[model samples]
Target: MGTTYLTARLNGGEARYKLPGGHPLTGRSTPDLELTDDGRLADHLHGGRALLLDLTDDPELRALAAGYADRVDTLTADCPSRPELAAVLVRPDGFTAWAADVGAQALTSTAGLAEAPEKWFGVPAGAVTPG
Candidate 1:
């Protein structure tokens, strides 16, 4: 699944939450991504382990970025101005589980952490303990 789709799914679920936005944009197109930052949508991928991909200069990655940008609203948050600087959280099955602009928080709450591990890391519900 794509970042937009995954974000929508997460928002629909009980675990939906937002973080205060003040994250700095990084990667090859930092300047472009920063232009779209409005600080409304809180970055959910804050502190948890994440998979970061640098697609700034890759054509294939750029194509994937376009697909994600077009469906930004569908994912439940403002899309980064440049999708190439975006980072997507992936489930063990290789499905996109969440999308966050670069430098944004990945996980900030127990619910967010639980959802990520269960949905993305393939960890069972019982296996995760809230902090």
Candidate 2:
């Protein structure tokens, strides 16, 4: 079994059982998700938060995600790519700090989601660099 499976088993497969509340990206490494705008794979130093956006629909959400450019390294995936989430803010440790389900109302604006990045990652525009 994989390390994650083993770890999850050890932790009772529940968020409350885990010391820090966050989930792994699963099925893909953080590097694989760090695709450039041209769709080429590239290395993304694990420093800033990663904002995963769904590119299948919702133009408004896409624009709202841009507001976090200073604090996050945004990445887009095709629709249905991640069925459970419409957007995710991943910490430098490759753990999801925050995730939003697929709903327009679930993530109305960047304001509602700003605290997670600041609390887990750092200040906006990288004012407080992640350790």
- Among these predictions, the greatest lDDT belongs to 2
Candidate 1 Cα deviation (angstroms), residue 37: 25
Model 2 score (lDDT): 0.50
Candidate 1 whole-model C-alpha lDDT, 0 to 1: 0.34
Taking all chains together, each candidate's TM-score versus the true structure is 0.24, 0.49
Please report, in order, the local distance difference test score of every candidate based on alpha carbons.
0.34, 0.50
Off by over 4 Å in 2: 1-49, 55-70, 79-81, 104-111, 126-131
Worst 10 residues of 2 by lDDT: 14-23
Superposed Cα RMSD, model 1: 15.1
lDDT of 2 by residue, 1-131 (tens): 69988897686553331223233432123323433353532344345546544434556555655656766676566433346555655555555555556653546444245456556445655255547
